[model samples]
Target: MGLWLPNLEYLNLGSNQLVGSFPMSISNASRLRVLNMSHNYISGSIPDTLGNLRNLEMLNLEANNLTSSGMGFLSSLTNYPALELLSFGDNELISGELPGSLGNLSSTLQIFFAARCNIRGSIPDSVGELINLVSLDLSANNLSGDIPRSLEQLRYLEYFNVSFNRLDGKILDGWSFGNWKNIANLDFSGNNFSGAMPDRICDLNSGLRYLGLNDNQLEGALPLSLINCTDLVILNVAKNRLSDTFPHWLGALPKLRVLVLSSNRFHGSIQDSIATSFFTKLQMLDLSSNAFTGLLPTNFFHNLKALSEVVEYEYDNYRYSVNVTIRGLELPFTITVAIPVFTCIDLSNNGFHGEIPEAVGELSMLLALNLSHNSLTGPIPTSFGDLAALESLDLSFNKLSGSIPSQLTSLTFLEVLRFQNNNLVGHIPRGKQFETFENKSYAGNLDLCGFPLSKECSNGEGSETEKHDQVNGKGMAFIWKVVLMGYGSGLVFGISMAYVVFTTGRPWWLVRMIERDLKEKIRSWIPKKKRN
Candidate 1:
């Protein structure tokens, strides 16, 4: 179109076969407000003159083959006092630093994104100059150096993500746990941030909701300050070097929904408060890959109102006596009580033994339950069928026995059911959700039979019991034959020994009689020999 529509306020030709450098004629559309030509075959540097559209408010030219020189095209947009949102993500642009001129944009700007553009170097301190910025995303870049402390100047900022960068240094003093009181979503994951968690992190209370600090070098005990943030919904601090007992303060957060503290150096018994008190609104909780022990509370699922509120509470009270009493009599009075509600609970990978509680199915809103890799025994509760919304259930590597619950087929929405490496017996349930699972899901249960497994159910003619009886009969027959042969051989040996001993007793007299008869015959024959 070559900017033929000068009156155009919005222009979008994205994902087309358009080619060549940006048309400089676009600068003629001084009234243009929105421009998008992303995912096209456009190449070469962006037109610096195109930024003359003073009324332009939103611009997206992402996912193209635009090169480094195109970065200069952005600096011209600073002249637009009305510009509010800008996105240049997912382009093969060369590495560069964020333009300091970006700080000069009008305070009316609300959203800014420059992810995956090879932008490197530290975030400019000038970023604090955009006081009205609400959402900022600089993720998936090569940016390095410390997160600027000046970021605390953004009092109105709500969502911020600097993940997947090479940024190093401790989380800035105020931003670490103190200043971001209005932040609802903060993702500093996939960075080189180090040091102990600041104590004031959870002091934001109802304002700070989702906190993701995983895959960092953060250490030290989980700060007790977390209990102060009664409005926290999701807390993820996985894959760090943190060392301490399981944090008990988690159970006190009134609104916590998802708590993931995996792959750390936490040790000690999983406190009963985990299951009995906290997590009332929890939907997904993963505490796997730690060194925890102790029996899981039997009533772990008893208090979950929606499988989300799984934190604990503190109670206190006071009493006083008044000096002026009615009718010249002295009187005193006192009252006390405080209660916290916790909903969902996950105590897997701990050394918990005994049967899973039937009350676990009471969590009607439970969506994902992972009790795998523990010492839990006994049959899976039939009550599990009551979880109408259950989506993912894993009970692998436990000592659980008995038949797979036929009622489990009621979990129509279940996408992942892992029950491997258990002692479960009986035929695998047929039809519906059971048939969808592969043999691996039911492996390590040698006594289990039916479809999906190689072993077939026993019939009357060749039942395992009948085969055992047949083998026992053959063994008895062989033993009896060996005994008869031994008795016959012993009789023959005894008879032969007795005959020899009796026959030799009269042998000497028989020898003398024979000698006298032989002497007479010899005397007659000797006389004839002498004559010869």
Candidate 2:
């Protein structure tokens, strides 16, 4: 095994239990372009002689217990002209300033990853000189101070992450990040940066497909400029202090597939305009923990062809959620957006009201549907039985009423059925699918019965028809009680009037005249109405 090929251009000894410091003999391969020695128990300082490999392009020494001497060895790499990709992540090196000479590698450098290296102090402004850099990740470190304004010069950067750091400063404004239109991913989450997101963060990058800016102090409205990035597939701006009405600009993006805007201060009704036809390719949409409210458009799922495919099949636990504002109230309205073509949909913790759409049954390929913690009402749609592929269904903490549809028993593949805290009634079906669920699945229901609960049918037997009749009888009784109460009150009032007429000798005209005289006196004493 020691008889190695002298012409080896790449040597990968990563993730093995290789002990001891990097073998200085590795420098013998003068033509080696790639050297990966990551995720091992490798100790001791990197040999400074590594800089002798003038043709080396990539050098990775991550995930080891290297000391300050090891870091000093990396400083020697400042002389290597062809060194393009360098990684020194997840090491125990003490805090130190990056050498300014790192800027000298501007000619051919493409990637520089130094995450979790415990390096502190301000990021060197010289880093902006790496004009040829395409990917730069320095996350999970203690680097602080304003991100260098000079970073805007990196026109070729495609993937950049500076998250989990103490960087503070307004994100550079008007910088042409869009210049890197070919960039597909960018993450700056978990930082202390404060200020409105740069208005042009995505201005030039129409081809950008993913952007994450969560867990920051970003304020102001969502940048309307993002609409220009029509190719975005994932956009996460959650857990920030963003304040504005719902971002209407998002509806313009044709290729957007995932949108997460939760935990912000956005307030407004989920506009019907945005719900009508946009988001044709959206698969995961989370607008939770906001002040959006409104009746979700009935046809909200129509334009999403992927959703429609799920609804057309027989599946189970199909889930979909819509956050909205209704009548000045914040609410989350959720449904089994799970159709036969999708797996899950979550619309919990919003201000949605109204009946669950029966069209949800068309999601035959759905696996899980969560519509919990909302103001939704009406009966569980019997069409839900069409979802044969469903596994988990959560519809708890809503105002839903009526009996659990026996058709739900058709979901033979269901594993978790959650409908707690709803006003559901009637005997729970004790069939193949129903028998598998426990009391926890149907707990908060006052009128729910059957195999899971001790409450039997009205006839003290598990009779399906008897249970249905019992539910019907309760409904009838409720209606009659209301009607009878109104009728009885009317009868009482009529009897009292008759008694008054019989007992009083005064005519009706005399009573009316007295009342009119009093009203005229009162009106005369009052001031005249003012003009608007």
* Strongest candidate by lDDT: 2
How far in Å is the alpha carbon of 531 misplaced in model 1?
Answer: 99
What lDDT tens digits, residue by residue, belong to model 2 across residues 14-85?
667988766877877888887877778887767778887777877878777766542566677877888877
Tens digits of per-residue lDDT for model 1 on 1-532? 4656779887777657988876778889888887777668777667778677888876767667777643577777777787776667667674577777673484757667677788888898877777777667787799899877778878777667798799878776555544556666677877988998657765556366667787889988887877887766667787788988877567677766567787778887654545455655554556777777766655555655555222343321101000110110112111011122111244556666788887786665554577888898987887676665565577889999877766666665565678889998766766566777788888888888878888887664235433433442221111111001110000001111121122344212112222333445434322231110
lDDT at position 473, candidate 1 = 21
Q: Which residue window of length 10 is worst by lDDT in model 1?
A: 482-491
lDDT of 1: 0.63
Once fitted onto the true fold, the runs of candidate 1 whose alpha carbons sit more than 4 angstroms away are 5-7, 12-21, 37-44, 63-65, 92-94, 106-108, 174-181, 202-206, 273-277, 308-350, 459-532
Question: Residue 188 error for model 2, in Å?
Answer: 1.2
**In angstroms, how far off is 174's CA in candidate 2?**
4.0
